[model samples]
Target: MSRIEWERIGRERRRVSRWSGGTTAEIAIHPATSQYAARNFAWRVSTATVEAERTDFTPLDGFSRILMVLENELTLHHEGHGTYRLRPYEQNAFEGGWRTSSEGRATDFNLIYDSRLRARMSVLEVPGEAALVAAVGSLPCEEGEHWIHRIWYTAEGSVEAADAGGNALCRLDAGDALLFAVHRSHGEESWSLRNAASGRAVVIESVVFS
Candidate 1:
């Protein structure tokens, strides 16, 4: 974990906001003071619950968004783009400027980034009593541009994390997250995590390059 900076965001640290549609909690954002509402962020990761039966999405003209349903079914109607019916953990990537609306209620995870930067989002499921090894800096990149951050959000259950040397990191419960950031030339770094509760654990992993 040398040369890397990490943060643990527990429940108390979350900035939860209520919108017309539902509530959204900001997990992490690039540049400490950047505003999501003002659309001044380079990237942002958040989880939101859509409570209204039908809700319109805010049009973000210069961004790209990746949204994943964490619970229930969600039907997204993206104007000019085909409608997408997504189940739990299923994600849809589209331009932020699309005229998008949703039908049905759901709790979702999102990664919205400036279109000029490269980003990737995915869901990882860890079975009960199982351990998973995850790595950052493994994504393919060019010489000048490289992966700089890796974020893991625990969406379900709890997970105990440890570094490559087996040093304890922290336990991430539902809505908790671990973010690691690094710079310069690095080959790869890994983290080991184990599910500490019954049933499967769902983790949303988002990787970004500056």
Candidate 2:
């Protein structure tokens, strides 16, 4: 997959629960397309929910998923295997249909990717000024790289970002996000998000490419 161009992924203004488990999820690219909706997949921007009492997931037929704990702490127990604990920003990948289990309640992010489109998926956290811009810009520079970049800034202050078009993508206050896409062959973009408040801002971007 190509690098994730500058985009933000964090919290959104929506939430849902699909499977038997009350495992509600917020979406960035909410699988509106036939191929995506039928596959029950999405690029999880940010999520927080109760842990499964038992293994509870709908299981995909032709897809897989990647998960990363954004905040809080939790343990994951894969059926017969031992339990694994994940810290903030830790990542893991598993078959979408694999019967796996969880151990505790915590918040996390997930990248739901189609197996037919790519073999694996990745999730990353970007911090600071220059690095964030470089990481996000890389996605659009590579060939065949296409991505829907979602950014959210939950810091106590305000943050701003721009696209190659020089249009203001987002001017975020606390508990807000700026969502946009970076297509193949897009030109260079610039952004300046500053914390108006005392707290620092957090950025998350999910890239789906091959």
By lDDT, the best candidate is: 1
lDDT by candidate, in order shown:
0.87, 0.53
Worst 10 residues of 2 by lDDT: 119-128
lDDT of 2 by residue, 59-121 (tens): 665666767676567677655545678877676777777766665667666667666544233
Model 1 vs. true fold: TM: 0.94
Going through the candidates in order, what is the number of backbone clashes in each? 0, 10
- What TM-score, over all chains together, does every model reach? 0.94, 0.68
* Model 1 per-residue lDDT tens digits across residues 1-210: 444678888867889999779999999998779999888998999989999999999899999999999999999999889999999989999999999999999999999999988888888888786689887556666566655777899998899888777778899998899998866466667878899898778889998888
Scored by lDDT, model 1 comes in at 0.87
lDDT of prediction 2: 0.53
Q: State the lDDT at 151 in candidate 2.
A: 42
Clashing pairs in 1: none
Error of 2 at 194 (Å): 2.8
Error of 1 at 117 (Å): 1.0
